[model samples]
Target: MLISMTSEPELQNGVGVQDSFQRLWTPHRMAYIKGENKPSGPEPTDGCPFCAIPAMTDEDGLILRRAEHAYAVLNLYPYNGGHLMAVPYRHVADYTELTAAETLDVAALTKQAMVALRTASGAHGFNIGLNQGSVAGAGIAAHLHQHVVPRWGGDTNFMPVIGHTRVLPQLLADTRKMLADAWPVD
Candidate 1:
């Protein structure tokens, strides 16, 4: 619900006063903020979404690509448009636990994700890496996943800064299709 202030009196009440600003209410974010789907334990069977995602169809999983050891999927709560994650199929908490093959596969998928984002949306730059653990900002600390966030000029502005919200122009399904089509053939 957007409250636009037409006059100065609206700011005084601080309630549902009409405001001039166009609000983009995102009630969905509450889940992520509240850690709704986070794993209950350190195992794949403990409700780990990353571990469970592979069993689902690509569309249902928002998966862009799949390799023997890892896969690329869209972030359920994206920091930017076309944001992706390269996740190892194994449920490992830290990057050090990944086998050589899993490490190589995740790195390859991460690179491919950047290429796909560039090809799909002309991404000017990217922010890629993984949080080592819960203390380091890993939302799903029970599993290892590397972030691949695409960036464009002026992509960051008052929306995320002042408003603390992001305006995504495309749906996740559509974005998934675009990235999947744009994925490099390996």
Candidate 2:
């Protein structure tokens, strides 16, 4: 049987299969998929993103706040709308390596991030934790950072499960602006 190019074909079950989905061609995501932004080596000077981000301007790095020994920056690849990470400047791989000062600063920054995210996005809740090593799902295992993921009701949906795509409603820069503006002064 000859099939017409203009119309969708019928399946063996006699149901018409229409080509409905419009492709959201995210070419920029190719770099992430190919691991382009990942660090070249274990050393901080060897292209560690967490280590390098603090050196850049706040807008350039999507940084929300900076403390003495630690800082908070928006996640480049966010699982949710307002995902952020609190990281130490020293580029220590393990949490145990943090000095008392670094530990306190990181914790303070994380609390500040939560308040910023809440004020910026009005998020209902959050997921805060750390993935220690590559085996534990740390994408950048050479640096230690605490993830602060904002959550909303029904944010989990079929798109991620069925299409393997996350539907982010806002741009990263815009999200950064909102969080930055909402960040506490102290």
Candidate 3:
């Protein structure tokens, strides 16, 4: 939908100078850049999505699987396709605060996520961990969650490094279905 006014050396609308590079428009990322949906406070009632998602339906929440104390859900802003998180239902901010049952459930779900991603997408490796706090890069620091990011050989390319954009081949809905189908049924 972006029409280039490159016929002239410079754009009259103050757009930009004409360049030989092609454009890849990812307007959806603007919401993230603008900090949309970010929680205003540290409480679950303060619009924390991790606390809210468990109450929604699986498809609506992009949830892959649910355990007794935790659940596995797809990341809304994924670092890679099939990127997911295992979150404890309790609104605990720190990992050390997790109950024994919650800890076991979260670990189980994270393992299930890895299995599902590998089965569905043939992921070569994984990046799995928790961002302890906002300072440690937790977007939603009010809740505790463990990330499960699938990785493949040569998945990193110049696009993310130079353009600061990640190219995801499949829609989030499709990925959710695929991983859900591949989830280990207990």
Candidate 4:
């Protein structure tokens, strides 16, 4: 396995890391964050989907990898179409709350997820990140996990600049199949 390295500095203490994450991601959300607590996205209601994925044997919005401690699902509101998130089963809020084993397991699952996404989506590269704290842009700032998003050379362009719309080329289900076929054992 290859180790991931980030030259990005340790998140600055009071810099609204969440906003930075948001801006770096879908620029359309920039308006919502100008003076708001949350951006306009799918709000987790009742039972959080990440927590419920393991028990249910369904795949409506579920994209890929359903397991005991780890799972991958397509972001309903994604930066890119095949954007995937590897979340743990428990309902922990921040990264510091995760045990070393859970942290390691999450990382392993994330790497495999990136490989799976690449095989299925034909992405040239990726932007894998974690929104650690609510202050750090954790939309579900409640649950901690890493997002593995695929990117192509000219994926982001004029619309996001002039129209404020973010476009993705493929259906999430197709992206799911590509991923499932690539990493079915998990």
Candidate 5:
């Protein structure tokens, strides 16, 4: 949330005037968000990170069953230990672009992912959502995906309110391996 403090013209270089209370995201995130560190410019091409997950299993921390149209990937910065994202293969922006069958498939996979994560991580519940537009907090607006974040009792405390930090126990790769091992076969 930012307010225009002065009559000064908008900053053109995208180094937007920082708000007084804003804290920094990670350095790498800043570069990626600012388009300085990203491999592709503006649009996705041959080397999309999500697309590379299935083919290059050694990287990207993919953690779930791979279907014809969609796959689940471990969140690099997880809200919880087994927080995962179910994303469509094609880079469609929103729900309108997805067929009814595709939407159903995403839902089915999301349910399976929740079960797998719960079994592997001992998570009691989940918070599932999809931020369709940037206003809703979708980081990659070009590719629509739904997040399945695991939750447990006592997981929430005063950290977000006081420390301004999130504590995650397992690394992305470990979570991926655990969840992938628990994925349903057939």
Candidate 6:
């Protein structure tokens, strides 16, 4: 005789127990956790996503704005909904390697990113900085990029704290379009 597991209920709970929690399935995040698009090494040609982003169209690369020496793009793995990053066109591993012109452009673009994020998302504030190396939490240490993360009051919730997951309401492409359209005209 074969015992059928299909007849069993998924779970059994006490009379007072209730399953009220919901799961937010974000399968796309597996790519990031698995380091799919990450650079192989410090070389620009070694599969560096930042180095390759400029070559693609704005929409395709999720680029919000482009300057002579740098550009602003939506973070693929954003900490918040409207996270952005300012990166130099030339791939460099360290902030100290930036030329004067590159440095200026990156700084200007970072400022513009805050404005665009504010206009597009009504962001209450921002956290802007760089993680220098892999040891310092830089996901792509091969390319220098400054993060411009938007923050709102009470934005942090139980999801990130208890579930170890972030629930971003808008899609990256949509966020990119919003920021690109709201970018300051210079």
Please tell me which predicted candidate would have the highest TM-score against the true structure. 3
Best by lDDT: 1
Per residue, candidate 3 scores C-alpha lDDT tens digits across 133-167 of: 99999998999999999999999999799978788
**Stretches of candidate 6 above 4 Å error?**
1-21
* Cα RMSDs, all models: 3.4, 6.9, 2.9, 12.8, 8.7, 7.0
Q: How far is candidate 1 from the true structure (C-alpha RMSD, Å)?
A: 3.4
Model 1 misplacement above 4 A: 1-15, 19-21
* For model 5, the run of ten residues with the poorest summed lDDT: 1-10
Write the residue-wise lDDT of candidate 5 on 1-186 in tens digits: 122233343467865664554342333334444744223522567345655566766345454677778877877656677888888877687888998777877888898897787778788888999998778887666677899998888888875557454666555677777888887664
Kindly give the stretch of ten consecutive residues in candidate 3 with the minimal lDDT sum.
Answer: 1-10
Candidate number with the higher TM-score (1 or 3): 3
What is the lDDT of every predicted structure here?
0.90, 0.86, 0.89, 0.67, 0.70, 0.88
* Model 5 ranges off by over 4 Å: 1-42, 46-48
lDDT of 6 by residue, 2-73 (tens): 112232333556333335555565778888999999988889888999999999999999999999999999
The residue-level lDDT of candidate 6 at 139 comes to: 97
Higher-ranked by lDDT: 3 or 6: 3
Clashing pairs in 1: 3-19, 4-18, 4-19, 5-18, 5-19, 5-20
User: Number of clashing pairs, model 5?
Assistant: 0
If scored against the real structure, what TM-score would every candidate get? Answer: 0.90, 0.87, 0.92, 0.69, 0.74, 0.88
Q: lDDT tens string, model 2, 59-105? A: 99999889999999999888998899999999899999999999999
Instruction: Tell me model 2's lDDT, rounded to 2 decimals.
Output: 0.86
For candidate 2, the 10 contiguous residues with the lowest summed lDDT are 1-10
Instruction: Give per-candidate clash totals.
Output: 6, 0, 0, 2, 0, 0
Error of 2 at 146 (Å): 0.8
lDDT of 1: 0.90
lDDT score for residue 172 of model 2: 84
